[model samples]
Target: MNNADSASQSVQTMYAERFATDLTDNRAEQKELTAQIERLRDRLEQLRTDETWLTGMQAALPGETAPPRPRRAPRTGRKPAETDAPAGTAVPGPRPAGRAKARPSRARTSVKKAVPTAAAPLHQLIRALMPLGEPRLVREVHADLAKAHPERGTSVQVVRNTLETLVKRGVVGKGIQKGTAMYTATAPAASEGDEAPAAG
Candidate 1:
């Protein structure tokens, strides 16, 4: 009975050591996985930051659209032996014919239609519409121009573009409203050079 009891005690001690070894190994592996997770998280954050920066820069470019991808040229210059030469003995290809002299292309000159200019140009008319310190939209100016000069033909787009030009020239002040430009005269807008007809 004494020998049996000693044998059982030794077996229990050996099992306990094995359990402790397994527990330690498991903890070490868990720590390694945790560190790897942290590294992956940091790398993912960096990639996201780079993507945002690239997007902003791409939008800022003058040409907003993405550049067209270049197509890969076919391997026409050096074909494979399978196609280049048939199973029969290689026959030399016929000599290339002499290249024809390239004819000089005739330059076509299109006749541009003459654009009718108003007695007073549209820029001057648009400037006349903007009173100093009073901001107006393109549509408003176009309306005013029509009322003031019934004969002159002007569109909203034309007026808007003219206002932008004036803004660049420091003749007008530009503002934004509802994603559209509003313009105001910065200085004396138009010269009153054209004398009004004397009232009866």
Candidate 2:
């Protein structure tokens, strides 16, 4: 009778151990599943934002004649050139090479106190800022620029646009890690004395 009692106790102990092990595995699985759900939700939000932007862009595509009605500025070409000078001062990438040379002369005449080194193309600065082989966020790059070279005072949007342009031109590689956009240099990182060779 004592032997039987011992056997029953041992069986109950084994069952208890099994239950604990199963419970631990269930909790771990729940944690993993919860993480996956959060990631999916984040990704879905990103996709929706992209979709809305893409829709707006498609509406403005050249094939759409509706855009021409609001684009009545073609009648005043000189006015646009005068207006775009400020845009050139603000963001250099979109302005044409011919306009670029013309814009800087006016900018230097106006904002002469702005650092000469800051006149270096933002794209060039980005090429200089990026380290080899590691992805970096636009804001991260902008922060370093703001810190190390405060003279090159620029906004996060400008940095982000410049990086995206570089990505399209094959001068930089873009990545999205956990819903954040990042860029890495495709060319060797530029040195203090040297500028990166532009991609064709």
TM-score of 1: 0.36
Q: Over the stretch 1-200, how does candidate 2's per-residue lDDT look in tens digits?
A: 99999999999999999999999999988985675566556656644443433333333343433232223334434334433453334343233333435545654364444444445677777777788888999879987776665644466677788887777767789989999997998876443224333320
lDDT of each: 0.55, 0.61
Question: What C-alpha lDDT, on a 0 to 100 scale, does residue 54 get in candidate 1?
Answer: 41
RMSD of every candidate to native, in Å, equals: 27.8, 16.3
Best candidate (score: TM-score)? 2
Candidate 2 is scored at a TM of 0.38
Best by lDDT: 2
Give candidate 2's root-mean-square deviation (CA, Å).
16.3
Instruction: Give one digit per residue, the lDDT tens place, for model 1 in 80-165.
Output: 33233333442311111011012112111110111232345667767777789898987788778767754454555667787777
